[model samples]
Target: MNPAPDPELALEVLTDLVRTDLEACNRLIVERMQSPVALIPQLAAHLVAAGGKRIRPLLTLAAARLCGHRGQRHVALAACVEFIHTATLLHDDVVDESALRRGAPSANAVFGNKPSVLVGDFLFARAFQIMVADGSLRVLDILATASATIAEGEVLQLVTQNDTATTEEQYLQVIEGKTAALFAAATEVGAVVAERPQAEAEAMREYGHCLGVAFQLVDDALDYSASQAALGKTVGDDFREGKITLPVLLAFATADETERGFWRRVLEERDQSESDLDRAIGLMQARGTLQATITRAREYGARALEALSIFPDGAERRALAGIVEFCIARAR
Candidate 1:
């Protein structure tokens, strides 16, 4: 029998399968990101040229192909999805005061925060222009709502940050808004523009949403997993930033009085010593909270696979399922 699918190979295959369409999308992204004001394009290019897996736009392209779309609109729409995602990244780095992204200096670090924010705004406007050009009101509505939801997610994250009292449900809500909303929009719009049935569109949305949640869950777990080089960020970013992630939440839930007080001091009080992150990892491991977080991520991965059951068996479906595996495997 064939061995279990290699998650990395699956993603590489998916990238190759949609390469032609991805090239078209890239061209459109380049065209749209250009501005008469030199600084706008320069700052935007700083982030856009950074290497990434380009998963969001790939989802759009793959979903359109999965739905058997015969038009060229998917290319532009995929670029639009990318613009939204990139804009969010710029804004996020500024808010998080992040220095690195995709293993390189973040746009906000290279360009000032003001320029990063303004360029992010430009990307948002460009995304809307592409959507309007597509002339699909349903697509517009879906992506527009996702933009607002992302903002809400960011705000919710801000409120929950440094608050050890944040619940798992609340944390899920934040990720659903910030990350999964765009994923849902990217895939759902592919179906929408393909003129697929509403039920199929909804299924695509659910698939993307579940996949995105699993993706974020793994990211959160990895923050404390001592694999920051693979993650392309500092190992203790979430901890230092006092973002209450799943592992921390689970750890706090089961901590003894002393450990509970420790969490409160480090996270709630934002008072961390140099050794705090090492201690945090030790606590999470001893308590199996990191493993538990991975288990939770796998649960979402399973749901993501389930959502794709509505689609017929095909390479696209298999690759999509493989993405779920890849997300969970990252934490392992």
Candidate 2:
């Protein structure tokens, strides 16, 4: 048997395997992102060409391939998935008032929020056009619903943000709608376009959902542990923004009276001093909450791996499993 692939290289290997289809997907993405209004394409291209890893689109392509699909439609569908994700990123940066994305100034920062939001609307419209062109109601329904769900998730997060009382269940609900919904749609549509059996399609959906949750959890942890270069943005951004991530949730759940006061001051009241982020990290470490979040990530990663067992063993399957490893290993 081939030696287990390094988690770090899993995405590279999968990219190599799916290079042709991905290239087609890229072409489709560029073509669709264009507008008679030059500024739209210019701003959209700025974000798209920035290094994003294209993991969601890759999942769609890999899922189609895993289900033995040999069609061209998956390429366009993968591009559609990517456009939805990119649109969200543009909108999210504006919503968060973020300065940087993918290690560069965010589009909203350089282009202004109005243009960024409009261009994001253009991308969303373009994504639907592609879905319609594919001419499958099932694909349209899946992606359309995911789009609505993502909006709901973002609104829900807004409601929960800076609220110290946000529960773990509520946090999971937010991530599920914002992140995992698209992931599940991306993979499930691959099987739908492939005409796979219902069981296999459901398996793909579960796999993507689990992987997405694990991916977001790792991102939350990395906001504390990773370097600026590793994260492609400033560390402690979530803390600075007063976002209540899993680590913060776990820490608050176990805090004493003094710790609870500190959390409320920072998270709820948004009253923070320069030293607060460091103290927050210290508290999380002392409470083992960061590790606890990572441990929860591992559980989801295992669920992702289990979901893949329904597929026949092959390079595609193995590479997908490596994605799970890579998502969790980033925490280490």
Per-residue lDDT of 246-302 in model 1, one digit per residue for the tens? 999999999999999999999999899999999999999999988987888888878
lDDT, candidate 2, equals: 0.91
lDDT scores for all predictions? 0.89, 0.91
Model 1 ranges off by over 4 Å: 1-4
Lowest lDDT 10-residue stretch of candidate 1:
1-10
Model 2 Cα shift for residue 200 (angstroms): 0.7
lDDT of 2 by residue, 1-332 (tens): 23146888888988988999999999989998988999999999999878789999999999999999999999999999999999999999999999989899999999999998998898999999998988999999999999999999899889999998999999999899899999999999988889999999999999999999999999999999888888887788898888888999999999999999999999999999999999999999999999998999999998989999988899989888888888888887
Error of 2 at 271 (Å): 0.9
Model 1: how far is 323 from its true place, Å? 1.2
- TM-score per candidate, chains pooled: 0.98, 0.98
